[model samples]
Each structure stands twice: as C-alpha cells, then as structure tokens.
Target: MINNFIKTCAQSKLSSIYEELLDTSKQALAVNNGNIAKWESAIDELKKHNKGGVNYQPPYININTSNSDTKLIQQSLKKLTPWRKGPYQIGDLQLDSEWRGDMKWDRLKNHIQPLKEKTVLDVGSGNGYFTYLMALSGAQIALGIEPFLLFNYQFMSIHTLINNPPNAFVLPLKLEQMPKEAVFDTVFSMGVLYHQKDHLLHLQQLKTLLVDDGELVLETLIIDKKHGKQIIPKDRYARMRNVWCLPSTDTIHTWLKKVGFKNIKLLDITKTTPQEQRATHWIGNNTQSIKDFLDPNNDKLTVEGLPAPLRAIFTCQK
Candidate 1:
C-alpha cells in the first residue's frame, strides 16, 4: 500500500514531501506489536479474493463485486475486528461498523468546497471510510493518517478489495508526525482535537497543513455554553479515558480564531445518538456503543455524568 501511495504521490502535489511522508509512515508502522502477524495474515487472506468497484449507497460505502468464499472473507475480516468508522458493503457481505460515517458525511459534504482534483488530508481517519469518500468525491489524492496500526491494516484489507482503488491511502502516522507543509487543499480533523492535551496546539498544527486559502473541516466533541466554557474530564468521558477536553461551540470558535484561521464557520452541531453510533459484530469484544456509554437512567448525560456527546463541525480557510 505504501508503494502504491508512493507512486500516486510522485504524480501529485504531494510529490515534494512524498519521501519524508513515506519514511515517517514506514517508521510508524514498524513498531513492535504481537498482533502485526495476525493482522497481516488477515490482509493476506483478503487479498486472495476478487476486487470490487466502490460507490456511495446511502448508509454504506458500497463495493460492487462477488466473492465465492463469503464465509471465509467474513472470518478473515473478523480477525481484524473492532471496525469503528464505517458501515460498508463489499459484495454480498455487509460489514457493519460501529459508526455510520455517512451520517456525519451528509451533515457537512455540501457545505465544504468540492474535492475535485484537490489534495486532501484526513487526520485520525479510522480505516479510511471518509478518506475513500473524499477520494470518490474526485480528489486527486486523499491521504488518511491514522496512528493505530490495526486501523491501517484494516484500511489495507479494504483497499485490497477495490478493483481500481481510488487515489486513497491510509498511513500509520499521527498528526504530529506529518511534514509541516502547506500542501493540501482541504484538511479534515475529525474526532481528534479533544484527545490533545493542548487543544490550541492541535488547532495550530491543523492550520499549518493547509495551503493559502485552503479549506479546513474540523469536527470534535463539544459542550453547550450553558454547561461552562469547557470541561476537562477528571478521569473519563463517554467511557473512553483519552478524552481531555470538551469545549462549548463558542469556545471552539474562539480557539480557531486564536489559531488565526479565517472565515471560521460553525457548520453543524448534532448530538450523537444510537442510530449514528451503535454496536455490531464488527466492534469485537468491546461491544459497548454510545447507548452503553450514556447514563441509562438519563440519556442527557454520560455514565460518568458529563453532558451527552454533542459534536460540532466547523469549516474555515487558512
């Protein structure tokens, strides 16, 4: 996959830093992990099957193709379990992931600039569902960077099945590891900001990735101002320990402005519900979804007593 990405990058705007990008991605994926062999075996099994054509079929990023060994494919996919960001259709099998990404895509797709022939970066892209959507939207190249090794392998599994895979690829690289180059025409930072210990720095790093007048699509968990400016969870938020901050929409707007982003526009703010995030067999043993994370007695708050998960999408120009 990295070899294919290197070839694609050599012909695109990313040609300038493709070497650095490739080196960094190689190092990131080279980390010692016992599961690497298992994940590679799954991808290898998936590669034996035929490839398919990709399309958008509403809730699913549909892939039209056939596989003689549906059960074998399913079992192989199960080896790379805990799919979190998609509800994809490959041939006859519906790999229902934890999050229905189409819901989030529909909310902001029309609002952003068209991706035709543009260079795009998807930060923290889990398994490249949206990254594939971005590429299908006609981007010259849509590069997804995810730090998790498993998600990168999952992306490769899916990529292996695409008949004529789009100029879409995922690398096991973090936002901090990226070359600080103003090359991408559109940069998407979704579900990533709050994890940062310094929210301001995250916004700053996002800004540095875009070219002059380039667009940025920022999405992350936020709180209503009525709750306070922002809340730093003492321990956990929504059953996840990595969450660090949940700012009000207004507070996030202020942070964007502080980072010198121009024409910052808050595009959408919607509370996450079971329909958008739910458990399925793809999520493995950690079947706990949004409903399980929320307070059973009161839907308005999480089990940890923080406000229910409300997310905001903001679009701005660099």
Candidate 2:
C-alpha cells in the first residue's frame, strides 16, 4: 500500500517529498500498539474475500460487490472498533459509523472548487472516508493524513477490498510531520482546528501545504457570536478532551486573514444534531455517543453546560 502511494506521489506534484512521506509513515506505523495484532488479524481475515469497486451511494462510501460473505466480513471489521468518520457499505453489509460523513460532504462539496485531476490533502482524515470521496470526485491523488494507526488500518481494510481502489491513500502521519511544500491543489482541514493548542499555527501550516492560489476548506467546531469571539473551554466540552477553542465565524475569518489567506468565505454554519453523530453497532464497546454527551435537561447544551457542538465551513485561497 505504501509502495502504491509512493508510486502515485512520485508521478505527481508531491514528487519532492514522496520518499520522506513514505519513511515518516513507516516510522509512525512502526510504533508499538497493543491492538496492532488484532487489527492486523482483522485485515488478514478480510484478504480472503473478493475485491470490488467504490462509489458514493448517498449515506455510504459504497463498494460494489454481490458475492461477499457478509457475515464473515462484518466479524473481521468489528476488530477495528469505535468507527468515527464513516457510514460505509461493503457489498450488502452496512458499516454504520458514528458520523454520517455524507451530510458534512453534502454541505461543502458544491461550494468548493471541483476536484477533478487535482492533488488533494485531507488532514485528520479519520478512516479515509472523505479522502475516498475526494478521489471518487476525480482527484488525481487524494492523500489522507491520520496520526491514529487504527484508522489507517481501517482505511487499508477498505482499500484492500477495492479492486482498483481510487487514488485514495491514508498514512499514519501528523500534519506537522508533512514536508512544508506547496504541492497540493486543494487541502482540507476538517474537525482538526479545535484540537490544536495553537490554532493560528495550525492554520498557517495548512496554508503552507497548498499551491499558490490553491483552495483550503476549513471545518471545525464553532460557537455563535453570542459566545463573544471564542470560548476556550477550561474542561471537556461534550465529553471530549483535547478540544481547546471554539471560535465564532467572524473570529475564524479574522484568523484566516491574519494568516494571509484571501477571498475567505464562510460557507455554512450548522448545529450538529443526533442524526449526524450518533452511536451505531459498528462503534463497538463504547455505545455512548452524542446523545449521551448532551445534557438531560437541554439538548442545546452539553452535559457540562457548555454550548453544544456547532460547526462551520470556510473556504479561502492561499
């Protein structure tokens, strides 16, 4: 799989750092994780099945296959639990994930520039759901960078089941680890900004990865203007740790401008609903999801009494 990624990158605008990307991914994937054996076992089990073609089937990152052993495939995939980003369908089996990613995709797809034959980067791509969509939308190469090894394995699981797969690939590498080369025609940073300790630096790093006049699609948690510019949560918001800041749309625009981005546009602002993020059987042991995180008295507020999750998407040029 790494070789395939290398081969593609070497022939694209990313040729300069293809080897470094491969080496970094190798090192990241080499880290000792107790669950690696189980995940690898699941992937090995999946190898016995036949491959298929992938396409968008509304809610699913659908794979076309009819003769698959649905029951066996389900069992193998269960090993990589807590599926957060997708609601993929392989054959007749529906791997319903925590997030109905298509909903997010629908909101931003038409607003952003067409991806056909473009080099795309999906930062913080969980399990490569949107990355696959980007490739299916006709990108020359859609590279997904996810630091979590399990998600990379999940991506590989899906990739393994696809006959030709698309130009989509996921690696266990962080955004900071990527070579600061302006190689990508489009870069997407979704659900990643709030996790950064320095949001400005994160935005700057994103800009540095794009080609001149390239587009950036930024999506992350945001609060209403009533929250007053931003809210730096002192503790967990909606049962999630590592969430540092929730800024207003205006504040985000300011940040983008400060970082030298041009033609910044706030595309959408939708409060997250249970329909978009809810637990499914595929999420495994932790059955609790968005519903569990909200306050019993008020759905508008989290259990901690903080404003609930509201996300905004912004597009700009580097």
Candidate 3:
C-alpha cells in the first residue's frame, strides 16, 4: 500500500505523499530506536515521485557597473521607476506593539532594535510582503531585490497604492547581479538560501553587497543531529528545484565566519508547524491533507535525506 501510494504521488504530481513518507519515517525512527532502513525506503519513494522537469530560471541581469559601462546601471535604475498605484490590502499577519515595541518584524529585531531609519536590502523580497512591514517599522529606505518580473510589478503597484510607498525600490535582478554600492545599511534574506545550488557562493555574494558593519538576517532549514544525510528528489517548483540540504547550526555559523560576518547570533528557533510544514507531502495550506497525515508526536525524522521541521530561521551581522 505504501509503495503504491508513493508511486501514485509520483505519477499524479502530488506533494502530500512525500509528506506522509516523511511522517512514517519519523515514526519508524522512534519505534526502531534509530534503525534507518524504513527511512531509506521512504526517501527512495520520494525520489520516484519527484521525477519531473524543473521550474523556470529567474530573469537574469548583467552586473557590470564600471565607469566605462554606466549604461547598464542606468538602465537597471530606469527599470526600477515606480508605477501607478493599485488596490492595497493589509497583510494577514499583524504585529504586537507592546511585546517588542518598535522592533522590525524579523528574528533579531528585539536585540537589534533601533532598526529604524536604517537603509535595508530585502533579498528575495517575494511580493514585497515583508518589505512593506520593514518600511512601516521606520526603515529609511528599503530596497527589495526580486528577479521575477510579475512579482516585481505587483510589489511596485501594491506599495504605490498603500499610501506608504516602499521607501523601497524593487530591483528586477538577483542578488549576485546587483551593483556593489554601499547604499544599504542592513540586509534581509529569508526562505531563499536553500534554493541556491551553491549556498556558500551565494552567501559570499550577499556579503559583497553589504557595507562594512552591516547586519544580515537569514532563515532556512538546517540538518539536525538525528538526520544523517540529504535526499535529493526529482521535483521542481516555480523555478526552484526541491533540493533539501539541512546543514547543522554549527556548520552554518562556520560558513558565516568564512564569509567574514561578525557578531553572528541565533535569535529565534521554532519548529515547523505540522499543517504548513515543508517536509510534508502537502503544499501551501492544504489543511485536509495535513490532518490526514498528521502525527502529533513524531516531530523529528530522518527522511528525504533531510531532518524534519524541514525549515528554520537565523540572524547575523557582517
């Protein structure tokens, strides 16, 4: 039955089955006291399910900004010009004013308050949701670097209509393609690092974009002690290949140090919610499917070549 389900998920392009495999693997670990065969079998099934073509590559821009080639930068800047206003909606998530008064809505805002009046670079500012939040928190200027053309357009239009223009400019280029101008005071990257093929190289690229003594906020999945290896599946989602590499916290700290970041700190750590958990076979907020595969006690698992919780968050400074 399990194998058939896995095969069905593979043939039907279903992600929920992968989530169930993850749950079952975790349960097997708890029962067998670390016997790994069940976990391995589950991962194999997941690979079979994800055997499809990958998502499209994000739009790319050239990064040459020398004095001799100022045209490119000029053209990029022109592309950044804001458009007419559109209907705006207050985001679903709300901030609690009293608990952490005047703090930026990120992992490290409490310890790093007075984030106000600082210029911020929101890397991978999907739809500018967080970008809008940062601007509201008194960030003097927020620059969002998003490579998707449709998202860039929506972010621009939304901000223009909100009566609270993004103090923010949306760049239609990836982080590596942006000019090395020390215009930003801080950098923010969330839910993005794991997507890069060369995570370390991308970290180095982010470092080059920051001014000396600037802070960077990052969040992604990390391998726990229990999970031994990563399992690469064949599935692709929206230009992002579903590759899960869970590095330990210590390993990530080492990477940050290697990239010359200072004052590294683990601000907040939260387990993945079972309903919206990334490792599960479900995508988005498919509550019915989540309830079906829900295993309340089996929180930790070694499946799909990655640890469960399937995601994590972190903050650091450069």
Backbone clash count for every predicted candidate, in the order shown: 0, 0, 8
Evaluate all candidate structures by whole-model CA lDDT and list the values in order: 0.92, 0.93, 0.49
Return the TM-score for each candidate structure: 0.98, 0.99, 0.57
Per-residue lDDT of 1-318 in model 2, one digit per residue for the tens?
767787888889989988898889889978889999999999999999988888999899998887459999999999898799899999999999999999999999999999999999999998999999999999999999999898999998988889888999998899999999999999999999999999999999999999999999999999999979999999999999999999999999999999999999999999899899998998888899989999999988999899989999999999
Ranking by TM-score: 2, 1, 3
Residue 221 of candidate 2: its Cα lDDT? Answer: 96
TM-score of model number 2: 0.99
Instruction: Give candidate 1's whole-model lDDT.
Output: 0.92
After TM-score superposition, what is the CA distance of residue 58 in candidate 1 from its true location, in Å? 1.6
CA lDDT, candidate 1, residue 147: 91
Better of 2 and 3 by lDDT: 2
| Residue 259, candidate 3: C-alpha displacement in angstroms | 1.2
Q: Per-residue alpha-carbon lDDT of model 3 for 134-199, expressed as tens digits? A: 665677656566765545554533332233133545555677765555545678887678777777
Q: Write the per-residue lDDT of candidate 1 for residues 89-122, one digit (tens) a residue.
A: 8888999999999999999999999999999999
* Deviating ranges (above 4 Å) for candidate 1: none
